[model samples]
Target: MGKALIEKGQIYRNEEAWELFSNLITEITPSKVFVIADENTNKHCLPYFLKKINFEKSPEIITIPAGEIEKNISTCLKVWEILSDKGADRTSLIINLGGGVVTDLGGFVASTFKRGLRFINVPTSLLAMVDASVGGKNGVDLGHIKNQIGVINLPEMVILDTAFLETLPSEHITSGLAEMLKHGIIQSEAYWKRIKNINRENKVELNTLIWDSIEIKKAIVAKDPFEKNLRKTLNYGHTLGHAIESYFLENPNKKTLLHGESVAAGIILATYISKDLYGFPENKLQDISESMFKHFPKQTFSKKDIEAIINLLIFDKKNRNGKVLFVLLEDIGRHKTDCVVSNKLIFRAFEYYKNF
Candidate 1:
């Protein structure tokens, strides 16, 4: 309860989220309440959500197949159909109860359904709670490309409950930490040092850390909602990171990397590039690299794998004028955006990551 209601959205921690949500929803009193979920949260999270809220009418529940592969136009059409069949209208309130995929796709459907329905986001996973839920960004992937099709729209309110994290997988927790680290890398050196102390002080509850991470992101998005300039700092690792994420997702032979896992690797490569291009301190790079490697095991990538990943960078959402624009760090807490990089440098960075 340190800082609730960031800008427009409401962020509650732990059990208090339920009462706040119940009160807020009861006040709005929508014509209908529709809850959306993926397979995982449907079975795991829905019961808790239903048990907490005292509704005038039981909300209709819609479940979709989970995972990134299910994020597409086809899946969206299915959600759209359910809303249409259920007579969801502008007065309807859609509650998205799940991780990034569920919240992302759910927001897209609700925003477009009848020219927008008021919706609430309840992010279950750490990724969603810290990064995905705070931002107004919502979209499904176009083919294997990540977030290529999405509109910018804030939810009526966002519900944050760490209780939902009890059922979350450990790997998903690690995945979200990558985003948390990015916040420090781009915003505050003091924040980065605190997170790096994870090795020494491992006893801290993730909920506290998560609150700080959300605050970091909220500070930036509050200034540049459209990602015009200041907000691009949020993409510190996402340019090549998205390319790596998309590459692994499309290749059957390669093990699929979680968004944050690929992002962890991308941050390493980008930091190396930053050192070469912007004089970022080598000691800082080493500490960041070691911390990331401690949590994420290195994936041995082939020469072809590197090339394929590099090629995918051209399709990055942050690209401009057919050039791959990078968000490089001049130092911790200092970022340089719109920087262009060459294939040769990317290859060298892969070599650095390999030997790192």
Candidate 2:
């Protein structure tokens, strides 16, 4: 059996996650406890979370429709209604069980309802486990712009169990792996080498990789929790990636892109920008571009599509002024944050991605 452990705010391994949940609910002793799941997690993970850990009050369960599209004020209103009707007070505890959408939406609801309520995160997907679940960043998108409305508030605890990945599809795993690669690109050469060579079929190896990712994230958040500077490196590919994700999400005629799939493209474009602007090594740029293409093959973007995606960057919450900003690399494992890129420069980067 894999060992169960707790460090910082993370409860590692499902067995320990169960123990940690059982203990936390008991110790906090809230007037009520609630578990929030999307329709997918309600079907896939909620039963297991319920059976593995017993709750003192049977815990009220709330379900939202699954998908990023459901993340909005409408959903938050519904959650608020449920909490108000259920008599959940300031001392209530909410456990968010699912992927990025569920945790992001749930965290926002718990933090805003009754002014504030304690909450825990039980991330059931790779994206949530590595990035969304820990950062205390919670919010929903505003139309084609991602994370337009949210708060920076930490959860009471987070439970991570790779077992959740058993039922996760390969495409989803690949999506999350994009973020893992971003972690490596921003911080460590060794991590990048290990990640690019990973056998996704190897569960043991994947688990270790996930643990390393969480540790890297933890270190970054501890030093720059508010995203004042260093934590911005985490946004390496997100500025353009989010625009791409949102564009596909809005355009039904095109193939819908997953967040990671979009990020993979964004990373490539950003890498090109890094090469052009920051003197990043051309050989390494070519190598990473090939590696990224292995997981995320090049996608054809029409001039119109590129135009819309670039327009969407203006709404990026990271923007300090009206200028569009990006987190770019000085080199792999070395990045500079808050660099403004011109529209013509961005267009050229996209062109490079397409032709390469």
Candidate 3:
């Protein structure tokens, strides 16, 4: 079994965590229980879950598409409609049983239905487990800008099973690891070193590392739940990263960038900016870049494409008062926020990182 961090909700890890889920819900005896998952999790994981927890009363399962595109108002509307059709009452409990998309969108749905209801998160992806699941950042993407419409509402509990990692492909695993790396760079070098080689294959031994990321997030969230202050540090690589994700999202010929892929790019660009603006060591920047490249392949984005991506930052959710406030690094594990830059500079930063 793994450890548990009980904050906004409890996050439980290890193979035995499923047993805890059964114990907690059986005691509550919710009028109706609903588990929301994406297609990927439903196919790869639901069987194991059903075998573990023989629900005295069968729970409703809702599955949606398994990509960032699906995290939108249309999807939320569909979920709300599904719950209404299922006769879900105020007493119903929602279990978000997939990765970041499911947890974020499902949490938003639960929070809005009947004002609010109990919801648990069964984060099957490392990205969701370490970052999205811990923070009360429930939302759906709007157009190209990511997570544009959302609310902050904590889950009742979070279940993290390292065994689930075995089923994910390398790409999916890489996505989650990017967030873990971000967590390390933002707050804990020890955590970063702990997860330096964490991929799907080596996840079994990274349980403590996973919890360490969660703890870093917990500390950040506890200090700034509403994102009124230090919480911005969590967006370290997100400013330009979100824009890249958005830019490719609308292009038919170009492949879509996964949340973590865009974030990896975001961090790289931010690191470059940190070096240029803050005298961050060149060796440190190279180390950070090399670490990301080893895990995530660099995409060949053209100059035009880079410029287009930079333009999308205007729509980033973090921008306030027409200023693109970015979270930057002074060094690994040390983050600062409230730095604003021009659109041209954003383009140049992308170009610099793309080449460096």
Candidate 4:
């Protein structure tokens, strides 16, 4: 069993993860257990999850539609109603079992229902395991704005079993790789070097890398749980990435992007901006661009799309006053937080991403 400790939660990995989860269930011994999953997880992951542990009472399973589109207050209202109707009290435990969407929305639901309820996260996707589920930042998007309504509430524990990845689509796996790469770029040059040659076929290596990413994030969050300073570095690529995600989500013409896909593009754009402003090495920029493009297919953006994405920047959580703040890097492992970036630079960054 692999374990990592966060401020208010514990993370367990692999076979030992199940052992820890069973122990946690025995300890909590809540009045009831509620498992919240998206449709895909309900169909694919729930059975395996049920088989692994014995529950004194059969847990109630709540299934939401599987997608980012379903992560909103309307869904939360329905879920809250279900919890209330099912006679859930503060003693009930919520087990969020799925990817980022499920965990994010489920955590929000659990946190808001009757003030608060104990919850555990069982992150099934790479994105959720390394980033979303670990951080305790749970919330749903407001309309097209991403993660606009949420709270930072730690779960009792987080269970990560790579076995769930087998049920994910290839694109989703690639999507999660984006966050792991961000971890390397923002915190560890050594990790960056190791991740540059990632081989998904080698399960052992991939799992090890995933754990390293989680540790990097865990260390950062421990230092700055509230994103007062150091934790802001974790938003390195997300500022613009989220805007692009929201724009695509609202637009009818473009195919919606996965969270990691948009972040992959945002990372490349931020690298370019960093090079322009901070004298980040040109050679390293080239290498980074090549690496990102190799994993994520280049996304074509029109002038209109770029403008719309930029306009959405006002909704970024990191914004201060009216200025847009970005997390820029002088080099891998050297990051600048809350730095103001101009529209002209942003346009240039998009151009750089488009032509790269």
Which candidate achieves the best TM-score against the true structure?
4
User: Which tens-of-lDDT digit does each residue in 263-343 have in candidate 1?
Assistant: 999999999999999999999999999989988889778999999998888888888889889999989999999999888
**Which candidate should be chosen as best, given lDDT against the real structure?**
4
**Residue 33 displacement in candidate 3 (angstroms):** 1.0
Superposing all C-alpha atoms, what RMSD in Å does each candidate have to the true structure? Answer: 2.3, 2.4, 2.5, 1.9
Q: Report the alpha-carbon TM-score of model 2 versus the true structure.
A: 0.96
Error of 2 at 102 (Å): 0.5
In candidate 3 the C-alpha lDDT for residue 130 amounts to 80
Count clashing pairs, candidate 2.
0
Give each model's whole-structure lDDT: 0.87, 0.87, 0.82, 0.91
In model 1, where do residues sit more than 4 Å from their true spots? 1-7, 199-204
- Higher-ranked by TM-score: 2 or 3: 2
Off by over 4 Å in 4: 1-8
Which of the two candidates, 3 or 4, achieves a greater TM-score against the reference?
4
Sort by TM-score, top down from the best: 4, 2, 1, 3
Q: Give lDDT: candidate 2, residue 221.
A: 90
**Per-residue C-alpha lDDT of model 4 across residues 46-112, encoded as one tens digit per residue:** 9999998789889999999999999999999999999999999989999999999999999999999
lDDT of 3 by residue, 59-143 (tens): 9999999888899999989889999999999989998988889999999999999899889988888788888888788998887
Clash tally, candidates in order:
0, 0, 0, 0
lDDT of 2 by residue, 239-326 (tens): 9999999999999987878889999999999999999999999998898899899998688898899999998888887898687789
TM-score on alpha carbons, each prediction: 0.95, 0.96, 0.93, 0.97
